[model samples]
Target: MAAPLSPIVALVRAADPDRFLATLFAPAAQREALFALTGFNHELARAREAASNPMAALIRLQWWRDAVEEARDGRPPRRHEVAEPLHAAIRAGLLDAADLLAMADAREAETAEEGIPSAGAFTAYLRGTAGGWSVAAGRALGVRGEALALLQRLGAAYGLGGVLRGVGRLAARGRCLLPADALAGAGLSMEAVIADPRAAAPLMRAMAEEGAARLAEARAEARRMLPRSAIAAALPAVLAAGDLRRAGDPLVVPGPRGLAARASVIMAGLRGRV
Candidate 1:
């Protein structure tokens, strides 16, 4: 009989269905480890949303950091859904502590009260968190060198698309993820974008276009540099590409769920393009 899904896997499926679906395409031997890593990422990314205050969020982040340190030192992780599986993945050589810790540090940027400082800063944040995770996933799957670099670019594109898709939800929580520079260039402010996203639709559309370009370039590079086995690690890019294609308005949200999204990912996976 197949082993039952772990709590971390369940949480990932619930919180980030796209990534969870992507994990299903991974080799069976690596699927659980990927789920564990992605689940840990979900927990950190959403820490602010779950906390009562900034202090609480910081505490949660610190807890994960400490957990990673313990796992690195060959200690059993604390008995929590994410920590246990994460520890196992680490022990199994499916993940490393430095990448996980860097991801955690990147997530702290999410709690910034003033929002991301600029477009460049937002991109850097995505690189450290999402791109860093992608690199770790690639390494776990035995990809290296140039392929890892391609995966980082793919991850950054995917992360940008994700941020665009989540604009509505983030704004509802009083967070403006649009770059300050981008907003200013459009004669807008963070407050203006948050209060009325329509005012910034053009700017967001442009950003989506840039992300789509990055995705295309990364896909081409992956085809040349990465083997078929490494494709699963970049599967999220398929969904991101789809969202970028459908991005029309800043306020409209990007992802199209149900059969269409699943089919897109499957097709991309079969073609080894993601």
Candidate 2:
């Protein structure tokens, strides 16, 4: 029988299936560490959803921030599924407390009442959250320098595509991930989009195009800079590109299509192109 998955791996597979699938491409020895990192990310990203209100969300985020600090100081992590594995990742030198803390801060920032202010702000947020996580993942995999930079770019592209693809779901909760500038450029407002999603199609299409551009840039850079071992760290690029292609449909979630997604990732891994 297959060995039972640890809590962190189970959490990752349940909460972020795409990433869980992507982790399958990683070197076997590193899979557990990668799951811990991504699972922690999933917990942070969903903190707000699990809370009853914004303040409650902040409290949850603070708990994670404190957990990271405590782990860094040699204290035992909180007795929780996510925290336990996260502490292990840190102790094993697969992750950095500072990076994880920064990610916590980014997750808190995402809980703002105001929607994204501009396209630039959206980009910054993606870089800080997704791009930052990519950096830590690369570090865990022993990637550095130029390869790390490429990973960040790929993360940003993947992040933006994810946000855009989830626009419909976010809209249901009165949340809008598209920046005000993009909305204005498309002649729509957050309120309008939330009330009627059809009004947001043009803007979503534009954001999709932007995500595609970033993916293209990251793909080109990865081909030139990333080493064979780091290819798994950049698998999100293929997933992001596929999502961008379907950005026009608000209800269409962006991810690799099951078997097709897995096949593409395998192909990319073999070719050393994320």
Candidate 3:
């Protein structure tokens, strides 16, 4: 018999795509279970950036870590919701508890780190979190080797895109994720960019340039390993990058309303319409 979906996964499955596409798009059976995993991830992120007490956040993170261990040990967790997806994934050999623990550990580390340091350090943190996330996605998709490589590339690029989009929000919590030296090297400053997204026209443009470059790199790597049929799987990340570029294009004030319409046409073409 197929193992039951975890309550956490069920929570993730219940998320509306428009509300949380990041956690959706899995097979129906795994939907809720995946959702729960993602929900826990989101909770960690929110805890890092939210205004609640630091002590409270630390307590919650500890609770999550302990719960994961319990689930891994084959014991039914006290909080069934958190235990379910984790237990299911473990039984299926879909994920290693160590990977999940690494993620929780990283979140715990963040509560004390305060500010992001050098670009190297930031990238390490980014990769750990982003890689950890893709590991989960990899488990859900049951991919390995080359297919896994594509997913990893897609996840990393997509995660970076999310970080950029979430910069303003992250900053509100007094956290600065922008690699200050890297930005300065690019002749930019977070304060200036944040002060006036328009005033930092060059900076915004530079960001787009960097983002496009990263997307291109990801696309190239993905194309090498992703089969033609897998293009559909790859589309969302490309579409997301396109959205970012289009949003930064000054000429497209309302930002290319036609892009989606055109995308639909292209998708249809790719699917073999005359």
Candidate 4:
């Protein structure tokens, strides 16, 4: 068997299986860096869940911010699995600290207990986290130009599908990310949805519509450009397509980590498309 590149793969495989599966198609030399990016993102996401309050969450986020800076400055990274590989990727010039830092900055919004305020706010979050991360991966893979932009947009669409997939889990923890306007139109509120998943039905439908539309638009645009180098970064679009189409309720779910998801990815991979 081939030797492992980094332990970050195990974490990425568990925390963000979709990205991990997608990474399999990346060049062997580039796989470690791709997982490092997703591993870093996974750790940043855990910071919110691991903290007790907003101040605590901010502190957790700050630790990552500091680690990125330390790595960029050539200083030793604070000891951590994800941080170590991320630091290496940064130093090796396979990844950019700027993009990693931007992802961390955007995650600061998770500190909000009131949930997302509007549709625009949701889009901004998607752009920063998912869009930012995919751009970082594409850059690491040497993807550039319109293909890069296409990758970023596709990432945002995947982010939306991800949010929908996690609605039940988030609500069970007293969080609701469905945009407030969409909630109002659905005659629901964040607190209500957070307390009762059923109330989110209409809002979920609206989000599903928006997510599906974005996926369609991204698919159309992708047909025009996405280069072979970007397929790994853009693979989440395949997951988003499957998830959005079969999405039921946030309180319920699809097995994106199961065989079905892998099959979808394999089919897309075989087509050399995302």
For residue 242, model 3's alpha carbon misses the true position, in angstroms, by: 3.1
Error of 4 at 62 (Å): 0.9
Give per-residue CA lDDT, model 3, range 57-176, as digits (tens).
788777777777876888774645655656666666655677677767666545654445467765556555655666565555555667755555555555555555555444444444
RMSD of each: 1.8, 1.7, 5.9, 1.7
Candidate 2's residue-wise lDDT over 70-164, tens digit each? 88888987899888888887888888888888888877656777777888888878877888778788878889787777788888888887887
Worst 10 residues of 2 by lDDT: 248-257
Per-residue lDDT of 59-109 in model 4, one digit per residue for the tens?
988999999999999998778888899999999999999989999998877
TM-score of 1: 0.94
Which pairs clash inside model 4? none
How good is model 4 by TM-score? 0.94
In model 1, which runs have C-alpha deviations exceeding 4 angstroms?
1-3, 253-256
Measured against the true structure, the TM-scores of the candidates, in listed sequence, are: 0.94, 0.94, 0.70, 0.94
Least well predicted 10-residue stretch by lDDT in candidate 1: 247-256
lDDT of 1 by residue, 92-137 (tens): 8889888899889988777777778787888888888778878888
Candidates 2 and 4 compared by lDDT, better number: 4
- Cα distance off (Å), candidate 1, residue 30: 1.5
- C-alpha-based local distance difference test score of model 4: 0.84
**Model 3, runs deviating above 4 Å:** 1-25, 51-56, 108-114, 184-204, 227-236, 246-274
